[model samples]
Target: MLVYHLYSGGKDSSLAAWILTRLGYDVRLVTVSFGILDNWRFAREAAENLGFEHRVLYMPREILERAADMAIEDGHPSNAIQFIHEKALEALASLPEVERISDGTRRDDRVPLLDLPKARSLEDRFNVAYIRPLLGIGYRTIKELTERLFVVEIRESEQLEKADYEVELRHLLRERGIDPLTIFPKSHYQSRVLGWRGQL
Candidate 1:
């Protein structure tokens, strides 16, 4: 079976897709862009390095604007990020050719975590199975997996060129005259997938 792995050019999603491919699931990487920024280009480059065919999925800019406003209102980004992530998941849910979809969200990832009820609703509404292979795995194991399987680049969130929604959401916040640094939690960092170490 084929699965659409939401690619962010980041280590977690790349690892999820890698595992799926090893299990004989044909996987295509898709980067969701709100059209606010061209960060999807970074994702595409990482996808190429990982040897998966990649494509861009465009979502409405207004949805991001809403998320930005919510973040500013709440003085934090957790709910807003989860909202944007679900929207991105829903955007990917409608592909007629795909029956399964996956992402990099893990056990301890609070922001952007898809709760069971919402996940089931997405599955029920779209008739697609939302598979999250990392949710059952903890942080330390994921770090170990990335260490063994990937060449990675790490940087502070805004400095990295990866396609994680946080990058675009930060841009959206900047557009609204609120510096993303203020709304975002301190000490945030991001990791981009440089390439796989070798075939498993």
Candidate 2:
């Protein structure tokens, strides 16, 4: 069966691909570019190392821009969640003969409400299965799996290498005993703060 792995080249995602391959499935790797995190090259290397076809889809920047806007504020908007997963689904649907789509999400990653169920629903609706092999596995197990396969760490692109200014600012605020999310206004307000520094 042909499977498409929603990969970010992160430890969890790569491990998901490895497990699926060991099960005798033909897996293809897919990554969505959201402007901020352009880790496409890393994803390609990971796919090549694992011996699977790799594809990258550049998601519309404006959509992710809106999601970022919502996430910066309130930190609990469903819009951002919808926007991201929708993009991933779109990318997956465009591939040919994709029997299933697998992502790196684990049980630990699904504490609060996200669109994971909706993702599964969409997969079913599209006649494709959404699989999460890493759900039961812990982080340590994922690392061990990658090492056993001699998975090489793919180099991140320059854009992804440079941290987003807002992230850096949030870290700085946390160090100063300030919850950036607590004090910073959501959406446009947070945009203004990041704007002063000339970026988000």
Candidate 3:
């Protein structure tokens, strides 16, 4: 069976591909670009370094924006990112031989109801299975796995940390004796709140 890893050339995505490869699966890596960053190039280079087949999908900025707008209209925050993710899935599904899709989602990625929200349920909507084998691990665990598997290490991007302004606002509010959830609730994007929400 052929499985494609939803690759972003990040630590988690690379580690997922490594693990699946070790398990004897034919794994390919894919990255979707919205023309905002060079993430697609990174993913391609990393995949080549690991000796895995890689593909890039360059999506139009307008399509991504409209997807994000529709997601928010449907009451999903940070719908832009989610829209991009789904678009990536769709792109992967169009490939000639892929049968399943996997990503580096971990259990530590908990963010209330939104992280695994019904909105991003690819299995239900796309009829394709999305797997997260690292669902119960932490960042440290992913690092350890990468080292053990001899996968190339990826540098963390500061842009990822700065992607969500409201989350930073919430952290500041919490220091002043305010519960950010009471003010903003779980409205921020999953990419923002998933890391810090449980820590708070």
TM-score of each model, in listed order: 0.96, 0.64, 0.62
Off by over 4 Å in 3: 35-39, 67-79, 94-96, 110-121, 150-200
lDDT for each of the candidates?
0.89, 0.58, 0.57
Model 2 Cα displacement at 77 (Å)? 9.7
Prediction 1 TM-score vs. true? 0.96
Residue 60 of model 2, lDDT score: 69
On the 0 to 100 scale, the lDDT of residue 197 in model 1 is 86
Which 10 successive residues of model 2 have the least lDDT summed?
190-199
Q: Could you say which candidate leads in lDDT?
A: 1
Q: Which one wins on TM-score?
A: 1
Ranking by TM-score: 1, 2, 3
Candidate 3 minimal-lDDT segment of 10 residues: 191-200
Cα miss at 60, model 3 (Å)? 3.4
List, residue by residue over 102-162, the lDDT tens digit for candidate 1.
9989989887887899889999999999999899999899989999999999998877888
Task: Give me candidate 3's TM-score against the actual structure.
Answer: 0.62
